[model samples]
Target: MSKRWIGLVVVLWVTACSPIDPKLKQYLVEGERLYVLHCSNCHQRDGQGLRRVYPPLAGSDYLKENLPRVICSMKYGLQGEIIVNGIMYNQAMPGVPSLTELELAEIATYLYNSWGTQTGLIDARRIGPLLDSCARPRPRR
Candidate 1:
């Protein structure tokens, strides 16, 4: 095999080996825009949630540890207690049902990786449609 061919194969392999989901990256970017507009207030310009009223999300265990619950919170709404970064917090986090699965995925993924985390990822878009995906149930008349 030629050296150029080897280079091409290496490039392909790197792209293929990348664990970060392509859509996740897109969502994280979108989530950044949305976070600035919608979430940055409480979550802070950084991922750090408010002291008592909110909670620090940058190094949040909630975003990093409890993946499913975080997904549910974003999908529906969170009312009650949450523990993040080993700190306990009880607050009401309004659901973001308005967010598309892609959007939700992006925000969560972005927040998670933004912190001290170097691995573990959330593809919440893929979690869409699951009953526990979110809380706002479809209303039936």
Candidate 2:
């Protein structure tokens, strides 16, 4: 085989071996945009969050352990105490009730994958039923 054909096969193999799926890439792109619009103000552009007030999403234990709650909290808001990365945060986070289930999934996908977590696409289909089961009303300030 010619050198050009060998190079083409090598490129194809490398591309096939890539871990990032096209669907995951699309989710990540959409999620990043949604995160910027809805979450970045509090979470910060780097996911570091505001000091002491807004909890950091990067490698957050709460997020890892409480995927359902995190999803619910985005739409219904959170008030009370939660521990993240060994630190306790008691601040209230208002939900974006206007966000659709698909939008929430995109945001969740972004949050789960960005910073340090490698969790892939959070599908909108999964989010719909979860949102229905949230049950709790949005907290009153």
Against the reference, the lDDT scores of all candidates come to 0.72, 0.87
Against the true structure, candidate 2 reaches a TM-score of: 0.83
Full-model lDDT, candidate 2: 0.87
Compose the digit string of candidate 1's lDDT tens values, residues 1-141: 999999999999998897866665676678789778768878899776777778887766566567767767776778777667767888788777777766767776677667676554556546766535445655659
Best by lDDT: 2
**TM-score, every prediction:** 0.69, 0.83
Candidate 2: segments with Cα more than 4 A from true spot: 1-13, 16-19, 138-141
| Native-referenced Cα lDDT, model 1 | 0.72
For 1-141, candidate 2 gives per-residue lDDT tens digits of 999999999999999998878878888898899899988998899999888889999978888998889999998898899888888889899889898988888889989988877887889899988877776883459
